[model samples]
Target chain A: MQVNGVEIEDTFAEAFRMVGSRILITACSRQWALQAATTMTGFATSVIGCGCEAGLEREVEPEETPDGRPGTSVLLFAMSKKSLADQLIKRIGQCVMTSPTSACYNFLESSETVLVGGKLRYFGDGYQISKLLGGRRFWRIPVMEGEFLIEESFGVQEAVGGGNFLILGQDLESTLRATERAVAEIGKVRGVITPFPGGIVRSGSKVSSKYKFLRASSNTPYCPTIRSLVDSQLSEAVNCVLEIVIDGLEKTEVGEAMRVGIRAACLPGIVRISAGNYGGALGQYHFYLRDILGGTLG
Target chain B: MDKVILRLKERSNIPVEAEAICPDLFLTKSQQEIEELALYYGNKGRRLGDFFQVQGERSDNIVIEGEIPNFKKIGQGMSRGNIHIQGDVGMHLGALMKGGRILVEGNVSDWLGAEMEGGSIRVKGNAGHLVGAAYRGSSRGMRGGEIIVEGDGGSEVGELMRRGLIVIGGRAGDFVGAFLIAGTIVVLGPVGLRPGAGMKRGTIVAFQEPDLLPTFHYNCLCQLSFLRIYLHHLREEDLNIPQEYLGGFYKRYNGDTLELGKGEILVWAGQVA
Candidate 1:
């Protein structure tokens, strides 16, 4: 399938099941809220290395937050339930708790949810207080700056991870331009994030080989600069390639981003576009590039 | 269960606790059976049937009428019933209640909602001391319930409260949040001295200026994010909250400094940051 003049690969992007959570951080001001969110979500690009993948979901008005302050909503994902809990406790304790004039709350509330405050309340030694208002329980831990309140727990949902598509162009400048526009478009569309650094990944990896100990290595097939040294898959015209890794609360949002983003990204300095897949579905919802980019191809 | 029609006959001075006589307990009991419930009045025990006539036959709700100036423990330890008092009620109106609701149309006596664990009690008139709180020697009070007073309130409101929320629309007396371990007390009226004293952790929000003690430490000036969300919760009642209180500024003080320095007293100084 060809979108405009760019070709669309028929392969699919395989995503795996992941545990997800949304955290709402409220601060005295928007700057402080964003500051804490940025720090908490830092170094969290991939669970394979950082134990979790997190990003800002959106900026919330004071009317929408608990405690009635300017806030930001953030999403987090992990491969395991325990890891997800651990990540939240450690990151929130070190980041949100340390940020001045900030309080954390679970974005979703429900029964049978993992208790974030129930676990972190220990930080208060024996002085922690649990306040239940309007059927919702919140923990108030005495901190140096008055008290830090956090919801007892947040809701967990089965999410999709590893949603992606490569942005290929004739040059690095062109590819970056398309990536910049696409990043801005998908930043806050609800339930989705491009977790890569600056929302772009330059060195994509593949299953291991050259080193017996390494299970996965760089994607030499798409390495246009090292085409001669590696078994490159560049179509001669494709000079630079960058990958965008997306994680969504639902598989359909991921599919929607791929549909809209692929169409917009295939416009100027681009050639053929493809995605990464783990072959079989392995109990995940898969999105085919051709199926979404079908009209453009025609 | 036809409410809005059942009216209590006015002018009974019998001090009766109504929380126990909730809907679940009355749905099966006949009017005579329900009226037989015992109540303590003026150092004597009286049945509910003699003080007030049971009007509704098919509902669990009971409407009490007349100037019941000596009513006591009206809804004590009630789990699943609603009591509507049309006249003034005496002390202990809703002590140790676990569930259900009690709405009093007139002023309430002392010790309203003392040591309640669950349920909601909204009094449209003034309430006496220790609303949504525990008395002396009690470590916990009002574990999970809500009390909304439309008019003024007496001292020790939410005193020694371990959990729950209390919103007072009128003036409040001293020690508003004294010894509060965990809970929220929002007073739209003027707060008396030493608010939140000895509180380990809790929130004391006053619409007017608060008299802070020496034991409280000045933390910093900043806006609280959770206040917006808290106001949003108040909006669930379809009530309009003042923007200055919801999205305004305040001085954040971390104190009861004599205790753990974890409790906070957010004083609204007419500033946002």
Candidate 2:
């Protein structure tokens, strides 16, 4: 299948099951809210190296937030529930709690919960105050700026991670531009995050590496410089490739993000759009490229 | 959604115990069976049909109309369903209620939501003393739920409350939130003498400056984000919340140092910060 002039590969993107959580941070101003969100989600690009994957999901208006302040919503993904909980506790305690005039609230309400403020209340050193309002408990810890209010617990649920699509172009600049457009479009989708820096990954990985210590290596087949030496998957016309990786709260959101991103990436100078998969051998979720382009995946 | 209406027929001054007339208890019973149920008229045990005119089939929705200043324990210990009181009610109006809702269109006497565990009570008019307060011997009062009083409140409101919220749209009398363990009480009007006295851990937010006791020490002034969240919740409940209050700063006072000293009183500073 083809969209706008770009060929759509028939392969699917394999995504692993992950545990995810959404956090809402509200502050005295929009600038501070964005600051805390950016800091909390920083350095969280890939689970392989960053311990977790996280990104800013969206900016929230005052009326939409629990504390009636300008807020930002962030999504974080981890391979296991325990790790996700640990990451949330550590990141929130260090990043959000330390920010000025900021408060944290759980963006989702689920039966499965992790202790966010419940465990961080120890920072108060016996001076914390707990208030129960509308059936949700919130802890108020005194800080230099005043006090920080945070919900006692955060809800977590199973999610899909590593939903990606590759943008192949005739040159480096064209491929980078297409990837940038795809990332801009994906940012509009809620409940999904493009975890890589600037929402684009240049070093797309293969399943394993020759070094026994490494679990993944660069995708040699798609590397233009090494294409002639390796079993190349790229055509002679394709010179550069950039991948957009996505993780979301659900498979439907991830699929929708892929669909939106792929459509946006199919611009001028883009040769083809393909996805990475382990030949259906590892991951449980499969996002077929044709199904996404044909509007069949929901 | 069957509604059972009970209108006062007798004009006796003696208070009647209508604890057993709750929606959960009357939902499954026939109207005749409900009327025949035993209730206390002052010190004497009498059938409910003897004092009130019972109408409609029994259901989870109950309506009590007429001048009922003598009706006590109107929805005591009720776990679920809805209750509507059209006029003034006596004491213990919704004591120990766990779930569901109660709407009072008129004034309510003392002990409005004493020891309530869950559910909500909305009073359209003034409420007497001890709203959401613990009983004389109980350790905790109004463990969960909410109480919204659209009119004035009497003294010692929210006394020893453990958890929950009480929002008063009108002035509240003296000793509001006294001995409060943990909870939130927001008064949108002027608060009477010595509010938040002896409160161990709780919050008292007043629109007008309250008469603070000597135990409360003045703290720094700042905007409280939690109040905005709480006001938003009240707005969702259809309360007429003042927009200016949502963005204003408040003068914080930490005390009842005589007790645990964790409680705080926030007086609206009128957009000062």
- Model 2: DockQ vs. true structure: 0.77
Cα TM-score per model: 0.83, 0.98
B70 in model 2: Cα distance from truth in Å?
A: 0.5
lDDT of 1 by residue, B90-122 (tens): 888778888888988899978898999889898
Clashing pairs in 2: none
CA lDDT, every prediction?
0.79, 0.91
After superposition, candidate 1 runs with Cα above 4 Å error: A110-112, A118-130, A135-149, A226-232, A281-283, A292-298, B1-5, B17-20, B27-72, B81-87, B135-139, B174-182, B191-242, B245-273
Instruction: State residue A27's C-alpha deviation in candidate 2, in Å.
Output: 1.2
Look at candidate 2 and tell me the lDDT of residue B90: 88
Candidate achieving the largest DockQ: 2
